[model samples]
Target: MDVDFTFRKPIDVSVILSTLLDAGMRSSTEGREVAYLVDEDGMFEWRTAAEYQLNEVMRELGDPRWNDRVVGMTLFFAEAETGGDFLFHPGRESMSCVVGINPKLFQGSSRFCDIGWYLANLVPLLEPLGLSEIEARDSP
Candidate 1:
């Protein structure tokens, strides 16, 4: 499912990284491993808190397609075991995050564009992660 949620404000980069790490740990405890996406290459290095400088990675992965609106934004985080990715956008007004499922995993009539099922599975997982302020919406 395609879901979008924004932070209440422009939160600190450290906080964002910490939150993502915490989520990954929690998922691991539940048998679902999550990791930060390093690059499009096969290099899937698991990073430690001390190893990452969010701003640096953001700069390296900046997407110009956003027209400078989301400078330093990066779509470089994903589940290590599963096949989904997270895109983080630190906009001037707020910060947004997206979680998407890999389409290649589905096929034939089973391939559906609607993200209702994905949202249903994700909302509860994120609720306890101190993201209550996030306003989430399902995109078409």
Candidate 2:
């Protein structure tokens, strides 16, 4: 179920950024399913036509809820822009390609408490992608 495997290498960050950007662009235009990868370090990076940085992604595999349940790791998604800045966003349907775990986990919770738990963990984990901090709309 792993979408793709991203080993830590010199191009690891750029590779991830490019894939996601390409996928996002395709989704924005031609409508295609996106593919991404994460390493054990929680480096959630992707790519498309350009490189991006996802140093801030969280690691859900280590969570108590998933200690034995989920394998692999968590990663953040990001994109680079023309201005040399990066933009991070909550992973949308497009950025996420699921594997190993139940896809249902991604669906929003009906219970307010469950939703709160989901976002609380998700926010800090995803903060490193720095989506909220960067306005990478210019596109890389």
Candidate 3:
């Protein structure tokens, strides 16, 4: 579940990341998700790099227990375990909309959250990052 929000001002997702981490919202994050184009199909066909940056081998191997797939992109400011897997748009600037990935599987896990939640909760948290520009809260 991705919650899209229209921001009144330019926003750099990386800055949001740093701010959240600094606030202990996320335990840690070293860098952005390492993306690898997995295919050219109708799908987005990309996967974040594994621990060894081995997106190819890991995808090929397809072993679940390996913990090698960078589970929800281990390096991201993703709280997959807490239903706050906020997606990062690397290098994006001046975007009118940003989707906040939210899963409704309960806070102890990944996926759906919203503008109601995104704005009310995230806006304040992001103020220190010099942004609180979300214009309105609505479901897409």
Candidate 4:
């Protein structure tokens, strides 16, 4: 399906990223995982991960249900070396989206691919749900 990522405002991508990380970490299934992304030039860069800052922000966000939810259905780490459009799929619960927080990886496989998948798909959904965009200071 053709997924829509329209947003009301320009959200600080980093903040949303950190929130996902915090939620993932708090769940305890994964201690810490960094989201990876592929740039225009096909370069890999590290995005955000579960860290002290994300935890603090999560605490401030103060939504137990939000943390509990996976935001989307199935999140995975994928690398399209050939370069193609992002793939969007359905999840068991509501929906699924992937975010490439980190840069693209040209060589070998990306270890942070899991987080990358989440960021690429979920970030756009944040605004519609009444979530505020990250501020300048919050963005990395």
For 1-140, candidate 2 gives per-residue lDDT tens digits of: 11222222212233334344444322211232222333324454442221222222222222233222212223232231111112222222112223222222323643222223233433443344432421111111
Q: In model 1, which residue pairs have backbone atoms overlapping below 3 Å?
A: none
lDDT, candidate 4, 54-106, per-residue tens: 44433433333343222321122323321112221122112223333343432
RMSD of each: 8.7, 17.0, 10.5, 13.8
Sort all candidates by lDDT, best to worst.
Answer: 1, 3, 4, 2
Report residue 61 deviation for candidate 4 (angstroms): 21
In order of appearance, the predictions have TM-scores of 0.39, 0.21, 0.39, 0.29
Query: Candidate 2: global Cα-lDDT?
Result: 0.27
lDDT of 3 by residue, 1-140 (tens): 34333344545444544455465554223443454332324353446543354334334423333222222221223344333444323222222223433332334434334435445546566655455334543343
Q: At residue 1, give the lDDT of candidate 4.
A: 18
TM-score-better candidate, 1 vs 2? 1
Per-residue alpha-carbon lDDT of model 1 for 12-94, expressed as tens digits?
A: 43344445545551222233333344334344443422233544554343433332233222232334333244444434234
Candidate lDDT (C-alpha), each: 0.40, 0.27, 0.39, 0.33
Compared with the true structure, model 1 gives a TM-score of 0.39
Residue 130 in model 1: shift from native, Å?
Answer: 7.3
